[model samples]
Target chain A: MINLKHTKMKNELIKPQGLVKNANRRQFLRMGTMTVAGAGLLLIGCNNDDDMVPAMPGMVSLGTGDIGILNYAYALEQLEAAFYAEVIKGSYFANASAEEKTIMGDLEKHERAHREFFKAALGTNAIGALEVDFSSIDFSSRTSVLGAAKTFEDLGVAAYNGAGQFLESADLLLIAGKIVSVEARHAAAIRDLINPGSADFAGDDIIDSNGLERTLNFTQVLTAASTYVKTEIDFSQLPS
Target chain B: MNLIKLLDTICPDTKSAEDRDRFYSRRDAFRQFGDFGKKVALAAVPLSILNSIPHVAKADTASLIGVLNYALTLEHLEYRYYQMGLDSGVIEAPDRVIFQKIRDHELAHVRFLQEVIGNVLNGTPVAEPGFDFTAGGNFTPFSDYPTFLALSQAFEDTGVRAYKGQAANVKESDVVLTAALSIHSVEARHASMVRRLRTKKGLDTVKGWITNGSIGSLPAATTAIYAGEENLSHGGVNVANLTGIDAAAVSEGWDEPLDMNQVLGIASLFLAN
Candidate 1:
């Protein structure tokens, strides 16, 4: 009999090593303590700064079902758009080669469109603008900027891959399918820029032995994303 | 969370002793085929169980099988194209490795789908079809590096669009849906790499992403690969109307899907039969 586990992706690819470190840094607060601050707005209570509870004050809820998935995507796109927008303004972009500038400029616009598309789709149900912190990145350095861009783009691909299962609506799933490919394209371009003309564009780290890209679940995606985002998103309502 | 649900259980006593004997005999047949059969046989265990599920409707499994077969056909086309391209010594030393990587992926996709459809799902895998890379003598891909690169770009982009078109069909099975999405993104990655390579080679009109659905220096026959790619509206929102993002950005932001008929129309050009 064939080993069925071969059909499933390697566990490490689906749940990367960063997940464990991320889990430790940002703890998932339980539900029931959440409060609806206003019509269509859900908030989570702030932690008391105890070791067990991470200080998650006024976290926004992504709600449940398909809406929650859209909100989750919207939040991630916001982070990406903000990151690229920052990249374009940085000294690295201003002093970069013509090709590099074109790539960065196009990336900024694509991410902005992605963020705005989700915002329009969700309409009133959309989550508020997420505040991202790029303090850890050195915008003036090409290595730093491209490195961050690569991370966001790759993570976005994985996020969409894993989130597809949780979506109840096929239409929503198709929409995600459309966006994830664009993210993958961006990821490849960023990787190529970082290491010109190398196979690292589709390196083994992200694409598995089976030629399939990484697929991280909701919690895993948010944990990795939490590194750059300052907003405390209460993903409790989002499907696991 | 039952994330990788490739058929949870097989109802006991569903298969007769004769059926079990036939399965074992088939396993013996598979062992003779070497690595491909060995890998397929590994996944065969669970898929055989899936065939005997009592409560799950037969159509659900059948539809999934159909989708897998459809994907398998495309993978086969890409695999053979790259294989022949490599064998013909048309690719230069600098670009050989990238094409090799892509070829390996297409082969993996072919084998992966074959394992599920032929062994797991108990359905027949589609036979590899004859291909004419020249597309009825319209161009020479083997002797000409530029034509080879053009076809590579078209096939990769078409793969991305084809998979996206089938996303909704496979959404019923999370296992299949996730796998398909994983492949879809890789196609996109390959497409980006090829397009960028073309731009560096002096096809300045091309970028990693499609520019307003233009096929750049590629022949007009490949126009279908980029057809409908310049879609500005998605889910009822015209992205062009969004602030700070122009019409080009809106078109490139989200890729549009090509239905099965549209894909086959393009694929048929390369299909010898």
Candidate 2:
């Protein structure tokens, strides 16, 4: 096996963030022996690096704790950002209004901003950007763009709502709470654009009889999300 | 703040035996704490202020009840706001369905919270206090569609912030925390929907999210609901660090939470004197 020390050091310099500069891999042993198990279980390294893979491959487990949860959130944001970024690359269909185009641009900026926020906050513990396959979405069609936006937005909101239970740190919880509302707002706007009426904004199908939005666990969310993403996300390791 | 009485008033017809027993036991548990139980309903510490204090989530059922009651109070105001609007026979012909949908959710939220907080009401649970969305002599929100929309926007925005403000307080209980956030996002969707309706009618120019102190002027009394929603910081990161990200754009990026006291300060305005 390649020397873990040499490979980690090499990867460290390559991914140095202008902000959120944290990488515990170099200090893994000293850190691991002294630190409480899973206290800061944000251990991260490439799986197929040939030198040393810090995490398991074949399917990436979002891990089992707060760090895992944050990484899980980061993965979703990446998919959303990539989707919006792609939507903007195509010309507006004839039926797409100026307002709709502007809204799409605004949403693109918001999703990209969210994507970067999670990436920076998680530091090196963050996963490398996963490949996204938005092939199923036809960016040029108004119906297609808004429909996919609605799905991602609603999914993002529900995912955060469900994932809040797993967050151990209140600070992380607050961040998730703040972002979830943005997703909710996005969902409403997309729904309105699709159907253009007050009734559609808070539609019945997505909300339950008690008025709560739909919820999905990590696995369920990954199931729907991975359809648009090329990456194989596995939540088998996430703890109850 | 007798929570049971308050629940009874807001939901006077609430005839659930399960709820009655739950509130009674919670009261019994609080009686286990004597006078401290009574104070818990009014003693909820806001999450922002809670940073300096230690979290005793495991040992303190009193604090948990305090947080739950705070949520319940806000739900009371929202349900009544919609209930009155629906009854006024003034909702635009096309929009009653939308308002009805929101009212149903608020009512559900009130019930959901009552159960989550122990499904119990105590001390008359603080009566449903009167609501005058127009603040006694102001514009008649219930009679005018524009005024009604403005008030709805205020209440929903306040609900979103109020829900967020309690996350830290409930973090100790995963079940309650998850449920609270679920409602929080729903409230935000309501806010965005109201804002969209207003924009559709040319009543305002607002984004789905509150942008840079851009909450349009409604009643002077309702100002506090949108107060501080312009904040651009998240945890420790400042949005200023990002390219092309300003405070205005940042404001839309993350919705800020309002402390319990601040929420009450606004809800109290609509209370029938």
Candidate 3:
């Protein structure tokens, strides 16, 4: 039996982890959006710093059902696209080698395309541009940048796997499967960059003894991703 | 309730009711295979459930092997592909470890599938056939690095699409579906690594993911893998109208799947017979 305990993967994607068998309203609030500048953050709803509630003022409810999951993915792509866009915006990172720069640059376009596709696929249902908070990531260092990339890539892969069971439509699942593997490829590339000369691309952290990649539920993902995002997300439509 | 609707309870994901007839014929096709056929026939019928999951032994037995074998054939091809690359002695020193690791993963997948399918069939099916990377003397992939990178890209990209295409049929068996997807992601990772290597060597300027027909047009011999990938439509919906994004990027964002026949056709190019 595949033991799914709602595991929270420990990585740089989110800060501070506490294990919970399931995600309730309290846990949902802890999940935040990741921010990147132009071509990244898209805020869907209102924001009230002073008002504190489970739905949270200015926080966007990922909505319910499949639409919500699409929104959730859209939000993550926004975060990743913005992060990479910012990475190249500066001095092209003096520390990054020429090869790293080219690959990372290419990565930015891929992420941006993903963000836009979800935006298109969702159409009227697409969430507003998410605003990511990147204060925690050190943009100047290659280690910091690639570390963030690795986390996003792995998280994206895990996210798709975790969400697979929740999806009801075969068409959606097929597309999701298509995208997840691509993300896995990105994860491998970033892993190679961060730690070359090793097979750590599918390291123990993401894979199990069975050679299967680890997965995370909506609640688990929100709990960790919330730290980097300014917009609060209500996952009421998703599994608790 | 019938087994499939009941299955909808635990699975929470079910395709439309219209697809039921399709399942019936699929299961019926396997009925010619002796006891395995009978088991598959029953598993395909959604009329009743002795238990919620039916018989695990039965479900994993018959048609499942067909899917597993399909997977194994590809894995066998991929495993040998990297193995041959390593033995060719043409891979650069820096990238040698990369190929070695990928080779190990493919071998693991081959072993994993063989182990499962072999257990079900009570014996291993068959050994891998000989391969021709050059595709009937069409080109020289081994001698030249650029040629090698292009072919590597094709294999990895095809692997991704191949897995995606078969997912619908495999989803019926929970264990098999999950395992297949696990391998699918690894294949995706392999494809990505190979693409990055291309860019590093300046053989190609491409995105991490296959876009609007695999970075750029591939040679006609290996073009089958990417045939339907350039479509910008998701279902009936055009991505551009939906998101206002460029049609090309919209198509690039999602990699499409290739049916079993399409995959076999591509894989056959490398196989000697």
Q: Note the Cα lDDT for every prediction shown.
A: 0.77, 0.70, 0.67
> In model 1, which residue pairs have backbone atoms overlapping below 3 Å?
A2-B41, A2-B42, A3-B42
Order of candidates by lDDT, top first?
Answer: 1, 2, 3
Q: Write the per-residue lDDT of candidate 2 for residues A1-240, one digit (tens) a residue.
A: 112111111123123241122234323533444322332222222222221113434334354466668878888988888888888887553356777776777777777777777777666555667878778888887778888999999999989988887777787788888889988998989998887766778788877655667677765677678677765553433546
Q: For model 3, how does the per-residue alpha-carbon lDDT over B122-174 read when each residue is reduced to its tens digit?
A: 23445787888888898687787678778888888888888888777766655
Clashes of each: 3, 14, 18
Model 2, runs deviating above 4 Å: A1-61, A93-95, B1-59, B118-126
Query: What's the ranking of the predictions by TM-score, best on top?
Result: 1, 2, 3
**lDDT over C-alpha atoms for residue B145 of model 3:** 68
lDDT of 3: 0.67
Interface RMSD of 1: 3.6
Report the lDDT tens digits of candidate 1 across residue range B93-135: 8998888989988987888788766655667789999998888
lDDT of 3 at A129: 74
* Worst 10-residue lDDT window, candidate 2 chain B: B47-56
Q: What is the lDDT of residue B246 in candidate 2?
A: 63
The estimated TM-scores of all candidates read 0.83, 0.77, 0.72
**lDDT value for model 2:** 0.70
What lDDT score goes with residue B79 in model 2? 92
Give stretches of model 1 more than 4 Å off.
A1-57, B1-4, B9-57
